[model samples]
Target chain A: MRVLIPIDGSECSKAAVDYIKERPWNKDDSFLLVHVVEPIPVDIGIAYIPAAYTPDEGAAFTQSEALLQVVLGDLKSVLTNQIDTKVIAGPAKAEIVDLAQEWKADLIVMGSHGRKGFNRLLLGSVTEDVMKSAPCSVTIVKSAHCSKSE
Target chain B: MLLNLLSAPKTNLRSLTNMKILISLDSSSSSQRAIDFALSRPWAEDDEFLIVSVVDVDRGDMSMASAMTSPNKTFNSEAERIVSEAKELLHNYLPQHKLETRCLSGPIKQAIIECAKNWSADLILLGSQGRQGLNRLVLGSIAEEVLRDAPCSVQIVRRKFSRREDQS
Candidate 1:
């Protein structure tokens, strides 16, 4: 199966990786790990005083690339089947759905309710958006924290 | 408001020897893919399979009262056809399993959940999405809702694809 997983560097999203790795899926199944980097927030400069050095667009790209690299490193330990990584810049929900549709992925497995469950007044913002809009079947694996709290 | 076409006996004889697997079925291609995936798994001697189809009255009705009325004759026949077709399709998967079929009415998600709970299903299997063309504004996700609240674990499957489209 072609599995598409979108990660955000959150432990919850990473737990999605852990869940897939632990499952002894057939070796023929391949995975596409996609990470979307939202553009630098417009208010970053105004929201906080320049107590620390500010990052330019190049700095931000480099940072996001490094984060993807770290995620790739972690996944390397678990995924023996064919796997690929992609880092793009766009809104999380739309980009993830577009990638899955364009890729014609058969399955989308991801962590559920990672960031917004506690603070955003609603649960599963990005994951829910993808689940509702994606072109393929989706599996929302509960994060370690989300499961524990439940 | 949910309706059951088949209210299983309180004591299901098959549950003792098999895992009661509730599989939601429809005429859609995605639903076929879900059945294909489930049957591919190596089966134990007794693994119960209940194929289900839910008619979403709420989606088409303007009011809950209109939707909650008794199942119309047209719907009753349609549900019967769907149940029989699903049973026939599952017959090829494992002939020894003695598969069951059911039809549910009401909002799609809640009806499926209620059926699963009533059957004491060990697992709920369904297509990730159903009959798309009604934009997100019209309908949210049935699979996502079931995943969050079902009494048991859920598996969402689709037509298997490869990493690259050309390879498939």
Candidate 2:
């Protein structure tokens, strides 16, 4: 089976990776690791700059690159041999579905936040969207051992 | 010949017990686990099994509403296709044993609870994605809800980790 795992570099996402690492997957099965980078609002960077210290486009680009490196590095360290990884720029939910379709993935493995009540309404969950939209099956991995602090 | 062996006067068919298992599937890996769990059991030939997939009514209605507003009317076709596909997926997995399926439309938790009640299932099995924080705050956990409200027992099967360090 071909599996697509969408990661956001959050602890919850890492928990998903951890869950997969512990599972007994078939030797022939392929795993794809996908990270979607939400488009950074250019206005935010422009808004924060002072008249005397204008934010350079080069600097912003460099900063984004550095952040991506850290996230990708952490992902690489956790992934096992033979797993394919890709970093794309788009909405997390939509990109995940797009990648799944592109890969013809048989399954999508992800982690859920386990939110409730008003908190859930205030912040819509991407896992929910992916679960509803994905062409194939999905698995949500919640961290059983980790508490709110860990 | 096998039937004759089983028909020996000493054998009691009444003594043979069949286990009842319930599988909740939604085109996910956890559904696969549910299937594997059911198949792995040392079930007698007469054992009964049920496979259920809950279609969220709110989601269906919301999509339908959105489609009505769309100018092209293309969303209607898309929605129909999706439902048809879901049904096909459900049918593909059914074989042997006593298999039944439902395409319920409503809140996932509510539909599941209703089904559990109507079926009087012995065990409700699910896969957990383990979403929490903001995501959980929004999407709600069907497994968690089922665990809390189901009339019968609930079993959550998580994905097996591939790494030794990650294992618990």
Candidate 3:
């Protein structure tokens, strides 16, 4: 099985990593960890060009790499299968879905803040977007702290 | 074989030790896909499964004539059959696993959430038909609601896309 996990350095994303670690995945199963760095808005009154990587974009790329490394280290302790990481700069939802499609991921597991009411409507959820567009199964893991009970 | 755990005493003993999984089903093929996804996954030996189908009695038009004719009976039996069929399929794959089935009646999303809360399920698995655009907004999505309100983690199974489908 091919599992794709998207990380964003949030508590909810960490919970998603924890969820994956706890599962008893097959030995032959492989995993791909992805982090998408949304472009930083600039106030320049000129058309932006993709020819050169801005310093801000470079820093975001570096930060995302570090994030993936930390998650990969944690997964390495429990999983011995082939685990790979990718860092891309794009909208998180669209990038994640496209990566799943390109990689032929059998499952895409991600974290959701699980916001409710007006908050959810206001914030809009990347997890929800990915769930709608991903090419394979999608599992939304909520942080244990946020989960509601009777 | 579908076993009803409503009155089963072993639930108390096994509740804490096993992972309780609540799988919501309907008459749609998407629900069958959810069951198939569950069967293909690896589970702990003692993990218990509860298959539930909620009969939305209020859905569709309820006219006096049809109401007098006992549409509730038909809806309930259909719900029962859906759950039992799902249970039987899962039982065939995991014959030794503890499995139970129930037919619930209420608003579909609320019933599923309430059942998961009451049963203390560790996970809730269901299917999403991947309805897009205007259809999704107008019809709304039960899977989305359950995922939002569920007391446990939720996995939404989707149709497997082949390379051929992707190309087209």
Instruction: Decide which is better by TM-score, 1 or 2.
Output: 1
lDDT of 2 by residue, B1-168 (tens): 111211223211122134344566665555455555443323445545666565543343344555556623443344344435533543454345565555555566787788777876655666553222126354337665665455544555544423331221
Give the CA lDDT, 0 to 100, for residue B102 in model 1: 83
DockQ of the two-chain complex in candidate 3:
0.22
Error of 1 at A49 (Å): 12
**lDDT for B22 (candidate 1):** 86
Model 3 residue A115 CA deviation in Å: 12
Tens-digit lDDT track for model 3 on A1-116? Answer: 78899977655566677778777676677899988876644654545445433434565666667778878888998889889999987877889999999998888988775223
Model 2, C-alpha of A65: deviation from truth (Å) = 8.6
- Candidate 1 per-residue lDDT, tens place, B4-102, comes to 101212222223235577888766666666776665544556678888888764445334353447545455556678778777867876788868888
Screening candidate 1 with a backbone cut-off below 3 angstroms (N, C-alpha, C), the clashing residue pairs are none
Q: How many pairs of residues collide in each model? A: 0, 32, 0
User: Which candidate leads in lDDT?
Assistant: 3
